[model samples]
Target: MWPGGTVRDVAGLWDVALPAEAVRVPGVSMAGFRSRTDRFVDMQVVPYPALTLFVDFGDGRVVDDAGSRWMDSGVVGLAPGGARGRGRSIDCLQVRISPLVAHAVFGAGAEFSGAMVSLEELWGREAVRTRERMWEAGSWQERFAVAREMLLRGQSEGPAVDPEVAHAWRQMVRQQGRVRVAGLAEETGWSRKRLWSRFRSQVGLTPKRAAQLVRFDHAAHRLAAGEQSASVAATSGYVDQSHLHREVRAFTGVTPNAVAQAQWLDVDDVAWGRGRAGARRLRVG
Candidate 1:
């Protein structure tokens, strides 16, 4: 049986929040999931895109899963699209930060670079955890304000990405052009070796590598929604279909077609070999 309260909220780079009605998974209660999804989740399972911070009342854990390659976090489970419901979950907010947002905050080199470390460590660790309960027992709006303050201050000033490199990254995405690590170095006015150094430290991966992952991320989403791989390449801007396959395989360790069938992740076995993003606890009983 589904629960009564279910709200899904999505946030984009605009800072404009979009709210969706919550879903109370029928037949199952949050009690059922208090074991798995609720445990402390700090394992890097597979590869995908996106870093997820989960706050589950059923238990208490933070899960980071990317569709292609997850954050540099260690392995815990499978894919990110897990379906286990939160029994009677209250309304909560989820924000999917775009690469641009990460770039804006962390600078060009570190945004969506596949590899990841705590944001604090990169900039010298002067930041506090944004989600610590401050007022305790208050409206969600009040809690949001406290978190926003910390987030805003964290990005006030410090190490930042070079504007030219940042601009080049976006242009490449817009054009769907080939990813060339050496060329990206020229675009950013840094030697290839130098670029990789800053890029890895700041963003967690090299520029070319990160861009390809981001591109593959979009393609996976499209394919899951029924867009064919060759077609996915055309829309996302690949020179040829095989190019898309290699890029996806390098990042995700799987081919494009495999990901489509692998889209429906469960609590246990996953389709593709995605480490973290492949595990989802669904309501099977």
Candidate 2:
């Protein structure tokens, strides 16, 4: 029998399924989602630090604010401005790939920087084939397995980012985005100029932007978890609660209080294993 799944209701509208077993891939995590009542879902896509891939297998139609519609799959890059997902009867596997792994798994990192692209554009016909295979799977476990195999294959075949760049990224994440760019460059033995250029080309965001995104993500989740904004800002490396408010507005076009109530973040602990205690262990190397 397939392992029993853990389900959580998001605002009583969607049922989220978390994998019973941890995905073994480094720098990757996934969650399966399905609508509960055939009601149309108009979900705000909160920007996060990683590259995201959404594979739809249900009979529903999914479209974004940018006017792109897809029944199969699409990729969301870092900091996609004001992206919202709209659809009915939706069922999909959402995968979040750390930019470090994305560099190898997707090959052309710069192309995805702050952009949304259909999977067809990135993987060509293989995108269709993979979606079909997942659609044919008997259970979420099977679908997750199929997706994992596809990512492993891509990682093996695609080019990798420079190790120095990878190290710098890991540092930023480890420090919760508090590490300085100059310090990272010194640690990587790359000059500041070389590090900035190479990191942007490979990771799809400048080190400073990536750090800001990471810090913002951490703060957003805390806000969602009901922490006081002032406390979060103080501990999350912000100058003040007002600074937190501004950063939240910059990223989501909303205030921190508004972000705290966003439905999209309601499932983070279950779906992404990001709880107040800590995050699920990710394979950094």
Q: Against the true structure, candidate 1 has what lDDT?
A: 0.43
**TM-scores, in order shown?**
0.54, 0.89
Off by over 4 Å in 2: 1-12, 20-23, 59-72, 275-285
Report the C-alpha lDDT of model 1 over 22-65, residue by residue, as the tens digit.
32111111111223222233222234333322233232233333
Give lDDT per model, in order.
Answer: 0.43, 0.79
Could you tell me the lDDT of residue 233 within candidate 2? 96
Summarize candidate 2's per-residue lDDT along 134-192 as a digit string, tens digits. Answer: 87887777778887888899899888889999998988888888889999999989999
- Residue 283 of model 2: what lDDT? 13
